[model samples]
Target: MDFELPEEYAAITDTVRRIVEAEIKPVIGAYETSGEFPYPVIRKMGDAGLFGATFPESLGGTDAGFFAITAISEEFSRLTPEFGYAMNQQAMTCPFTIFNWGSDAQIERFVPDLIAGRAIGMFALTEPGGGSDAAGAMKTTARRHGDIYRLNGSKQWITFANACDTGLLFAKTDPAAGHAGITAFVVEPKRGRGYRAHPIAMSGLSNCLRSCAVFLEDFEVPVENRLGAEGEGFKIAMNALEYGRLTVAARLTGLAQACLEHSVTYSKERLIRGKPLGEYQMIQQLIADMAVNIPAARALTWRAAWTMETGRPSSRAAAQAKYFAGNAARHAAQAMADIYAGYALADEYPVKKIAAYVNMLTVGEGTPNVQRILLAEDALGIKDTDRHPVRNRARGHLSR
Candidate 1:
């Protein structure tokens, strides 16, 4: 398999890098301190035609496909991993879910705003009962009431809940049906309706995005708003994660690259024991290990993306990439910190922030334990009925 990215894909990401350096990074520190999501910075991202790089031109995107999304994600994340979260939410999750499974009207109503960046989008599958047991533990309910479904229960740790223009939500439509009864819906929060969102003051990632606690008090969703058929929310949510894990893997690839860059630059400049730190064997080992880990994780992530691009089954691939890359990025963060020594604690340097970024990535897509369990399931030859929707999506890409 050819791992080299096409030239155009490289150009798109390089453009993203330039915009991030010139417009976004200058104020990242300020956002970190204030716990604010900069609307203007995101608007700039929209104006630059980034919000929909993966979407088709008919939907106001570059039609760059999954690779473009991965490219954009990696470059932004190299600076700070938070923007990657926003990208995944906007371009990868909600949009991917809608474009693939939503009704024609649903796509027309929701996707254009998201693609334009005039409206931020969010995906909520995690409930108060969220985590490894997300599907079985989900308690949110959507009761059919003739023309509309009434949504009750709450979702926590949802990115951009308070700030999003549209929300792709999952709820149990039939408790007796278990996972089968769950259904997906698209709601317009920016237009104002049944749901309420409150900001969550998180320990990390406060600067790049905000997590929100969303409460649905009889939020009315029209039957037309239903995503996919009734009882398919579980499948939709699971499929969304396949793509999400790919982005997380790529983002971690960028974080590992950041770790590599920081260490290399610091080693050349810092003097220790009457010599440059780069000359030390121990420092050299750290750099070598980081360099190794980065390309290793990046290769896995790119392979996962390519697998998706090729329209092949990729659940196991996504899980493996996310699991390995997350650990690699975390270890790289530590190595970078060790190299920085006392300076690691200082905000003036990026290593401390790198530490915080990896903490979030390690758990964002799904924890390492979850990925391991999935890989074991695949190895044990368990029939993965849950993988069909995602697999079908990947396969359908070839037809497109």
Candidate 2:
């Protein structure tokens, strides 16, 4: 297989790098310090079409494909993981899921604004009770009344839930049906009533990008807002997460690279015993580990993206990539910490923040343990993670 990215993909990466350098880097620190969302920078990213890579041209996207999205994720994450996270919320999971499952009218109503960055969106599936078994453990319920569905439940760890204009919310319509009973709905927190979101303070990436606990108390969504059929929410949520995992892997890959770059630079310049730190054997070993792992993480991420792009089964690929990349990022961050020693914790250096960012990656999309379980299940032939109806549908939609 050809490992080289197309020239167009390289250009896209350059564009994202330039955008980060010019717009995000300058104000990111202040925004992070104050814990405020960077609306202006997000607007710039929207204007540059950063959120449109995986979408079709008809819907304000460049149809740049999954690889382009992967490239963009890495570049945005190289400087700060928040923008990379934002890109996933705005473009990959929320809008893409709606585009795939929503009616044409729904797509027309929601996709453009999200892709243009004029509006923000979120995917709410994880609940406070449990995230790994979100479907089976979901306590949220939806009751149908005429043309409306009254939703009553709480969703935890919903990224941008407080600021989102619109989002996809999942609730159990048939609690007895278990996973099959879950259903997806298009929620308009801003326009609709009875939706309340409270921000959950986080130590890492909390300043600009934040998550929230969302409460839906008698929140009403129109029947038209329902995605797919009843009991299809489980499939939709899982499918969306496959895409989310790919982006998460890409972000971790970028974070690992950042750690490596910083560690290498510090090792070469800092002198110990009148010799550069790079000359020391221990430092060299650490740098060598990073140098080897970053590319491996990146390659795995690209392979996952390629599988999705080619309309092939990708759940296994995504899990493997995310699992490996998360480990690589953690290793790189620890290595950077070891290399920088006390300086790693200083506010002046970005190393501390980068290391903290890696913490979020380990648990965000799916925890490393969850990935391990999936891999183990696949190995034992207990389940075929790669094959799914959603994968087929995504392939067709993306190929279009």
Instruction: State model 1's lDDT.
Output: 0.80
> Which regions of candidate 2 are displaced past 4 Å?
1-4, 390-400
Report the lDDT tens digits of candidate 2 across residue range 1-400. 4366789999998899899889987888798888777777777898898998877888888888899989999888987677887977788889988988887899999999998888888999999988988887799999999999999989998998988887999999999999999999988889889999888877645566888999989999999999989899998888888888999999999999999999989998999999999999999999999999988999999999998888777899999999999999999999999999999888788787898789887898789999999999999999888757544334574321
TM-score of 2: 0.96
Per-structure clash totals for the candidates = 0, 1
* Colliding pairs, model 1: none
Give the whole-model CA lDDT for all candidates, comma-separated. Answer: 0.80, 0.87
* 2-64: candidate 1 lDDT, tens digit per residue: 356789888988888888889877987787678667777777787777767656677777777
Instruction: Give candidate 2's whole-model lDDT.
Output: 0.87
Candidate 1 regions with alpha-carbon error over 4 angstroms: 1-4, 26-36, 384-400
> What TM-score against the true fold does each predicted structure earn?
0.93, 0.96
